[model samples]
Target: MSAYDAVLARQSWSKLTQEAPTREELLPLVAAAGRVADHSSLQPWRLIELRGDDRLRLGAAIAEANGDLKPSSKPLRASLLIAVVVSFRPSEKVPRWEQEAVASGVAHVLSLLLDEAGWGVIWRTGGHTRTAAVAAAHGLTENEELLGWLYVGGKPDGKRPGRRKPVDAESLLTRLPSAEGIAG
Candidate 1:
């Protein structure tokens, strides 16, 4: 599919099968997604793959962070969870926020690539993401911040594509006024 078509067809899939892309299948898509625009080439992002017992551990951590007696089932919703982390790099030229944006771009691009590859995917985030317990679960370092996780699995059998409302492109896009208008 063309880039435009792939993007237009992309949708978040909350219901997915237990099948997920293996490491060999996912690495190529991730490599492609890593080509996102980065100022100073500061690859300020990394992904952590979680499956089986790893997901259970994350669920327990999430439960502890939320002060809940029962572990959260959120992590088990998908066959795989890719934790998106923003690894801040010291740079006088690029601000921390810009680096965060670059990391976010990687996650978004990865989601698109996964969708195009016939994998069901959804980006999940919550208030507990920044909690100490959650961070420890992902083995995040002091310089890294958790953005979220991309939950991925196989598209369900005979599931129809999701319908999204048409975007109002004209309303969202506008040209800046000319110098004459600004002066006037």
Candidate 2:
């Protein structure tokens, strides 16, 4: 399929099975996705793969932060959990927000790649993701922030493809109000 067609076909599926991509299979997909529009080449993003016990540990941290004593499986919904993190580097040329956007772009691209490779993937985030306990669990430094987790696994049989509201490209574009000589 064409690149655009692949992206349009990608969907976020929460109903995933334990079958998942190995590290070797996942590494190249992530590397390719890293080729994003990054200003100043700050490369401020990082990804952490959490599997098996690691997910349990993260769930424990999240549960503790939420005042719960027991770890829950809700955060460990998939066979693999990729934590998309953004580390802000002090840059006079680029703002922190822009750097974070680059990281977020990486996450989206990674999700698309996984979906194309027959993996069910979903980007999951909540208030707990940004909490100190959760950050510490992921070994996030003070300058680093956890954007969210990409839950990935095998898609169930006979599941329907994802659907989205068709967007009107024209409605999204706006022409600047005509000043006397502002035409471009």
Candidate 3:
């Protein structure tokens, strides 16, 4: 699909089916996402892709950490889950927000790629974004944020609903000066 068309067609797909992509298929998608322009080559993001039993472990960990926040065992298992982590290391030159933005951009591109591959994908983040328990399980740095998890699988057959929404031109675009334009 065309770049604009892929983005326009993309939607946050929460409900997924039984089929999922292989690791080989996902590697290219991850590479596509990493191509996002990060300030310098910091490459501040890391994705921990979980499938099968690993997803089950994550579901259990999430349930234990959240206590009663999520539903029961079956629904949480999912066909595949990807943890988008912001592995931040404080830098004198770069802002923390920018690092986080790079990571978020990676996740966004991956979502688009998944949609292009005809797989349902969703990004989910919560208070656990900065939680120690969640970070520990994935061996993330102490300062990292559990930005969100992407759930991926196939689209079910039947009536498909379009998610096109009215775009307000003014509300969508913000006229702002570049950092270089601002005084240091």
Candidate 4:
């Protein structure tokens, strides 16, 4: 499919199955995702893929952080869980939020790449997800921040694609300098 076609076809699929790409298969897709529009070439993002029991451990940490005694496998339902982390580099040129924006862009691009590869993906985040406990669970240092988890798996045949509300593009788009100014 063309790049534009892939972008249009990409939809967040939460109702995924246990079928996922192996580490070997995922490496190339990840590398492509990393080729994003990074300002200053700081490369401020990192992904930690969690498979098998690691998901359960993360779920447990999430539960604990939320004051729950039992862990919820809700987040672990997917075959692979990737923790999208923003690693801060002490840069004089780039600000922290800008670095985080780059990291966020990388995650979004990765999700699109996964969609193109016929895998379902969703970026999930909540109060518990960004907590100190969860960060520590994922081995994030003080300089690193846990952005969210990208839940990935094969899309079930009958599963519905994520809801997309109609957006008015004209309302969101704007041309700088009014026609009156130009004519003046």
Best by lDDT: 1
Candidate 3 lDDT by residue in tens digits, 1-184: 7999998888866567879999999999999899998887788889998777776666556666677566336426358888998878668877999999999999999999999999988777777556565667778876777888888888777735346587898987987889888868
Q: How close to the true structure is residue 164 of candidate 3, measured as C-alpha lDDT? A: 59
**Collision pairs in model 4:** none
All candidates' TM-scores? 0.94, 0.94, 0.85, 0.93
Which regions in candidate 4 have their CA more than 4 angstroms from the true location? Answer: 177-184
Residue 142 error for model 4, in Å? 0.6
How much is 23 displaced in model 2, in angstroms? 0.3
Which stretches in model 3 have alpha-carbon errors above 4 Å? Answer: 68-77, 159-164, 174-184
Which is the winner by TM-score between candidate 1 and candidate 3?
1
TM-score of 2: 0.94
Q: Please, what are the lDDT tens digits per residue for candidate 4 over residues 89-164? A: 9899999999999999999989998998889999998877678779888999888999898999999998898997
Model 2 Cα lDDT, one tens digit per residue, 1-184: 7789997788778688889999999999999999999998899999999998999999899998899989867766887999999989999999999999999999999998998888999999999989989999999999999999999999999886566788798999988777965856
Candidate 1 runs further than 4 Å off: 161-163, 177-184
Model 2 residue pairs with clashes: none
Q: Each candidate's root-mean-square deviation in Å?
A: 1.7, 2.4, 4.1, 2.6
